[model samples]
Structures are given as C-alpha cells and as structure tokens.
Target chain A: MTEQELVQRAREGDELAFAQLVTDNEKRIYNLCRRLTGNPDDGAELAQEAFLNAWRGLGKFHGESSFATWLYRLASNACIDFLRREKRRRSLSMTVSLDDEEEGRQAELPDQGAGPEERLERAEDRRAIARALEQVSPEHRQVLVMRELSGLSYAEISQVLGLEEGTVKSRIARARAALRKRLLAEGNFFGGASSTR
Target chain B: MCDCEKALDWISLDLDGALTPQERRELEDHLAVCPGCAALARELAALHRVLPELEEEVPEGFQQAVMERVRAEKVQALPAGRGRAVPWRRWLSLAAVCAVVLAGAGSLGRFWDRSGGTEPAAGETLPVQAAQAGAAAQAGAAPQEEAAPQKEAAGEGQGPELRLYTAMADPSGAREAADSGEVLPEASPLPTVGAAMNQAAAQNEDLTEAQRAALTANCAAWLQTSGLDPAEAGLLTVEAVTQTDLEAAVCPGEDQRARLDLDDYRVTLGSSDVLLCDSATLEVLGYLPTV
Candidate 1:
C-alpha cells in the first residue's frame, strides 16, 4: 500500500500499520536526521520523536499531501523542537562524530570496511561539507539538506516546507552558492578536483 | 534566445518541463550553437546528477534505535502493569531515553498539561479529547500508567500549563503567530496533549490565528538566520480538492478530481481525510490538469 494508505490505516488505531511504516522508511529518515543533526544520538532521538508524533498525529493527517511529505514535515518539526529544548540543546551542535557514521554507512556502502586512510579521507570530506553546511541559514541549510540529503524533488520540497517552488529553487541555488563560497574561503572546496568558475 | 539571459530562464523552466514547444525549440537551438552556455549546462547537469549527495546516511542501528524507543513507548502506553515490571536498572535507562525523546516533542508535554490535568470546569465535553487520548496512549509510551494517568489527572480538574518550543530571542520572534496562520506546524503533538486536542482551545480562532502567525514568523526568522542544519525541510505542494463544485475551479480532464492550486503551488488533497479546518478560505487559483 502507498505511504498515505498506511498512514490512514494507522490513524484508525492500527499499531501494526504504523509499525510497518517505521520499518519501511526508518533507515532513510534516521539517516536524514543523523546527517542534519550530525550526531547519531540526536538523530536517533529525533527519529523516535518524529515517529511518535506521526503515530499520535496520524488520524489528524489530511490526504491533501503524500504520506512521505507529511512524515518529512513531522521529522523536520521534530528536529526544530529538539533544538529548542533544554539538556540536549548543545548550541545546536551534535555530540555524535562522523567516524561512527562511516561505520554505520559501511553497512550499506559497497565496501563493508575501508582502510583507515580511505575512511579518514572520507570523514574529512564529510566534515568539510558538514561545516560548510553549518555556516548557511537554517532555511537555506534545510533546502540544501532536503535537496542534497533527503533527495526531495523541488516540488516535494515546496510541499514539505509550504513554500513556493520558486522559493525552494532559489533558496537551494543560494545555499549552493553560499556553501561554495564558504568552502572556497576554507580552501577545501576543490582541494583535488578543479572547479570551473 | 540562446543568449545567457534567455538561457537562464529556459534552464529554470526546462528543469520542470514547463516550457512551450516553440520555446523548447528555440532553447535547443541556442544550446546547439552556444559553446559557453553548453558548458554551463553540462556543469549544471553534472550537479543535478549529484543531487543525491545532498541527502545523507543514517547512523547504524538507527532503525533499531527507533524501534527500541517505539517499543519502549508502547510499554509506557500499557497500564500500570508495564512499568511495574521495568527493572529499576532497565527503567532508569529507559527513563533517560524517554526524557530525551519527550524533550524532542515539547508539544506533547504542553498538550498533556492543558488537557491532562484539567477539564472544562462546567461540564464541557471536549471532542478533541479523543485525539489527546490516542496520542497519550501511542506516544506517551512512558513509565507505567503512561498517558492515561496524566490525562486522567487533567480530567480531575487541576492546574495546567502550555510549553513553548521557541526561545523567542530573535527580534522577529517577538510577534506572536497569527492565530490562523500556517506557521504553527508545531501544533501536531499539542493535539494529543491537552491544549491541541481541546477543540475548545481551537474555538478561539482569533487566538489561534495570532499564535499561528507568531509561530510561523518565529520559524521563518529561524529559517532565515539560524545556523543550525535542518533534519528535514522542503517546500510542500498542496493540491486543494473542493468539497463543493459550484465556485470550485476544477482542473480540466479530471471530473471528480480538482487540484489545490495557489499562485505557484499545486496540491491534490486527494485522499487523506481532513479532520478539522477553521475556515474553508483555502482559495484556489489556476488549475494544474497535469497534477
């Protein structure tokens, strides 16, 4: 069944249906949270919170949108909400490390394990991208992350964010420009690959 | 038309296949002759190919973690029996986890207080109670006596509180949400708790509109200036299907289907049930038959 169908069923007090959704998209959503929050712990928490919120709010979900879109909305809001709370609010910086993330992605990547040197190199690139991302506005960062990390189409992004598609496109374009600028300033954007200006 | 100016416009429209046939022909003609623009297009295409890179990978056992939490929450949903069996050590660990998760959903806490610890003093039956109870049961998977006890507490008519998720430090954050504004996306968990589930709270549409506007502005300001990365954020395409046909502008071709078209937005609120709407002012603009 479609994601929306699952949501409809779950809203009708179906725990199994909600559980199925948790199984189907948990990995992607978890990973999306991890990348955005930059900490496995926070990502895990946010993912859990989103699911809980989704399960509780399922009945209220209107089919005016796709279930994924609705889930993404909850997930995004969960992240924002998490950042606002005490005890876990660490300047919005995550306590999780990218090294551990590689160990996790290793599960899905072609190579289960990479040499330390290769892994370290990948980690550094990730850090660079993450740091660059940290410099942009949250809206811009959201658009970039949703576009780059969540792989949402412009239309989907627009729907999830309740913004016009032009706004989504413009923000993404600007985010790319900003990330390019920051990375360039750091002299790490094109460390090995030459970028044609 | 192949010149950089028109080329840029075409690039945007072409990405969505919105260009007319004649415009497509002219744009292609320009692409064929313009080497500089062609290189730029190639670069853009390459970037498009890597669009997937923008999305990232979740940590290991992310799902396991979610399931563990969900299971733990479910246990919490159980009556007093669930937590009585939770060993102290295990309970402590779960307690730590629950504290963290609930913090992530501040709306849950606020809602619970508004509804859980109190009832409308003069025999007011709240229809929104069902939403709160269900959420309390499902998400309140906490220590034993999960959500029921808290809501039952509210039902007994005691004090209540509402939690705000924002820091409200930004100058722009000063404005309260328009009670009817779409900015209050954080209203989800509140419904399950006391505040959101209480349709009576929603009865104050003026208040809701104000709150909604303020919340939207608060989020917008954050979206505009905050440096924090978003876990997920995107534009949503909304397609509006009118319940009535008289004044509704249905998209061509689809007899029973209508697209929720606004100025550059299109969504088909096709199948999902709408539980509540303060007003049906969701006016539609043009029709997107394709959508």
Candidate 2:
C-alpha cells in the first residue's frame, strides 16, 4: 500500500499498519528529530513517540496533505513543546555538545571538485547558517527546517502548520529573508559580492 | 500594492508558483524596466534558489523526530493500554479474582490490616509471609544488584521523557523458534543484532525480481530439505544490535511498552523492525519513505 494509505489505516487504529508507516519513515524521522533535538537519545525517544502519536491520531487525519507533512507537523509541535518545557524547567536550549556541529561538518562537503578557498567558503557558509539558525525564533527556525532541510513545498508547509496558504508563503519568504540577513550580518555572504555560481 | 512590497510579494509567490500568468507577466515587465526592483528580485530569487538547496541545520532525525513527537502525544491521548487492551472477558475475570480475594478475607482478623488499622496480630504473620513469597517469585533469577546501578543511570538522562520502543523479548529459545521462517541465513554481523537483520533486507534493492525469485526458490528448496515453512522468517542478524537491543535489555522494568508492529514481519527486534517481504517483494514495486 501507499505510505499515505498505510498512514490512513494506522489512523483507523491498525497497529500493524502504523508500525509499517513508522518503519517506512523511521530514518527520516530520526534524522529530523536528531537535527531538531540535537541529542541521539532524545531524538530516538521523540522519533518513536512521533510514530505512536501518528498511529493514534491517524483517524483525525484529513488526507489534506502528504502524510509526511502531517506527521512532521505533529512531531514539530511535540519538539516545540519539549523545548518550551525544557526552557521552563531549565533556562537552556538543552545543551548538546559540539558533537552535533561536528556531524554537520561531516555533511558539508559535496563530491565535485572545488578549490581550497571554495571549500573554506562553503564550510564558512554552513557555519554561518548553523549560528544564524540558533538566533532565529523557534517558529522561524522550524520554517527553515521544513522548507530547506526537509524540502517541503509551500502547500505542504501550510497543511503541516494549519496555516493559510498565503501565510505559509509569507512566513517562508520572511524566513528565507531572515536567514539571508543573518548570514550577511555574520559576513558569511559577501555583501554586494559577485555571483560565485 | 506598494512598489517595494510588490517585489517581496512576487519573490514570495514565485517559488510557490502561485503568481498568476498575468502577475508573472506584470512582474517580469516591472523587472525589465526597474533595475532596482530587478536586482532585489534577483537577490530574493537567489536566496530562494539557495536556501532549499543550502541544507539548513537540523539536529538529527529532523522530520522523523518531529513526526515522532507528534505521534507520541497523539498516542498518549489514546488509552495508554494501546495494543495490550485486555479483552472484556479478561478484565471481568481479573475483576472477579480481585473480588473473590477481597471477599475471602473481609473481616476483623489481625491480617485484615490494609492501611491505617491496628498493628498486625500473631495470626497475620502468615498472610504477610505469603505476600513476601509471591514478591520473591517475581524476582527469581534477577538480583537487586542489577537494578540499583541501572536505576541510577536512568535517573541521569531525565528530560521530557516518554516510553519509546522497548526490546525485551525473552532471551530464550522460544523467541528464536517463533517466526523462524525460511529466509536465507547469511553470516551474522558484528555486535550480533540477532533478529534486526530484516532492516538490511528491507533496504538494498540488489535483490531484483529474478534475484527474489531465486531467493524464493532457494528458500523453498531449503525449507523442503530442512522441513521449514516457505513463508517463515528463518534467521535475523543485524549489523548494529546496539541501536535496538541494548536499551531494551537495560530497561526491563518499564511501565509502558510501545510495541512496534512491524509490517508483515513481526518486530522481533526493537528499533530495527522491518516492513515484511509480503508487503513488498519483487511482486510489488517498493514505496520510498518520506525523505
């Protein structure tokens, strides 16, 4: 069956169907959770929890968007709730070590031939993104994660967030703008610089 | 719309492909003449082009994690007794057992002391001793030694904790014997993931249609030779048992268990559960997970 169909079945209280859905989506869900939570253990917990949550709430699913979008929205909401609770419980962003940054570094490279300076610039760009992302509001950061990292479309974003299509478009625009501003301010991008591409 | 805001609006709607044909024409017309608006449009377009491809920072399991947390809350809202909701007959039987036990001793005997009653009388010692024996039976082989240090370790990683998947299949022969259907058994991987090898099988589409047919033939041959079920899962061996096995091995005392009902294949391993062969064989083209 299709993932969406499996998801719909899962919503209807089909445990086996939902389990299949979780299996299908586990890695992406785990990676996304890892990025958002920045801890392996917490990510694991949250990823599994998201599956269980999806299974139970599957009946309420309206099939309005891709199942992944709906599922991620649910998970994103959960992560946000966790973050808020952590903020209340302890005024920290649940300090994960620089280990996650190290992993990000590992992912920064592409296989194409580039000069040393180009590599440096790319690394710098990623670092700039990492720092700038931390500064954005959680909502803004989430929009970036959904649109950029997850590569979701505007309609998908709207469905995931329960936002109007126009609102999703605007927020995404602002989020991109905000990211650009952050990177530029950090000098990660050359202001008025000529195109490297 | 204001000229400045117009550029922003166009930039925003552009990626979504939401700009009407007329709007696109109007915007392109504006850009053709207005150098400033054009530069700004180019800039926004550049940002738009870059961001999605730029690979924004995510913690780990970005989408999966979010969906998981969402799924967890929704699951929690359901009766926590999710899959294990005992049938009505079982519940009634349990209730009857409790009622009978209570009825058998509803009296002024010294052993009748449940909470704020007087001290236990001489005769009550036997009942207390019986209760202690029952408790001891539950702790037969496992000692208190294993619990103390483990509990401390669990206490250390406390956060917005929720019971995820647990991997506490009894480490006995029965687990192996159950669902030991006839798939080819390759050499086991390091750390011995026992039954989690189904994941690799699920991934790695090198086993194309002919290969699957060959595998099915091989399985049928092996099963016929060795008296195995063709549909049976023969043996599972995972590369990294660390992910699925270790945690569940540690947490045997968990109050809640979220059983992962692996598709077709039973979730013999905790984290490494697979969508079984019956769902997607060479017979069925596979479905990709949400990336």
Which consecutive 10 residues in model 1 chain B have the weakest lDDT in total?
B158-167
| lDDT over C-alpha atoms for residue B286 of model 2 | 15
Once fitted onto the true fold, the runs of candidate 2 whose alpha carbons sit more than 4 angstroms away are: A8-16, A27-44, A59-66, A89-113, A191-197, B28-43, B53-291
Model 1: runs farther than 4 Å from truth?
A81-127, A191-197, B2-61, B71-291
TM-score of 1: 0.47
Q: Model 2, residue A97: what's the lDDT?
A: 31
Q: Candidate 2: what is its chain A TM-score?
A: 0.76
lDDT value for model 2: 0.45
Residues A1-197, model 2: lDDT tens digits: 99866765554434466656666666556555655664556656776777666655555666777778777877888877876776688766544436355345344446269788877765655555556665666677777777766777787778778899888878877876676666667663645752221
Q: What is the TM-score of chain A alone in each candidate?
A: 0.79, 0.76
What are the per-residue Cα lDDT tens digits for candidate 1 across B191-228?
A: 32224212323232212322333322333343344332
For candidate 2, write residues B3-42 as lDDT tens digits: 5557666866776688888788878887777766666566
Find the candidate with the highest DockQ and give its number: 2
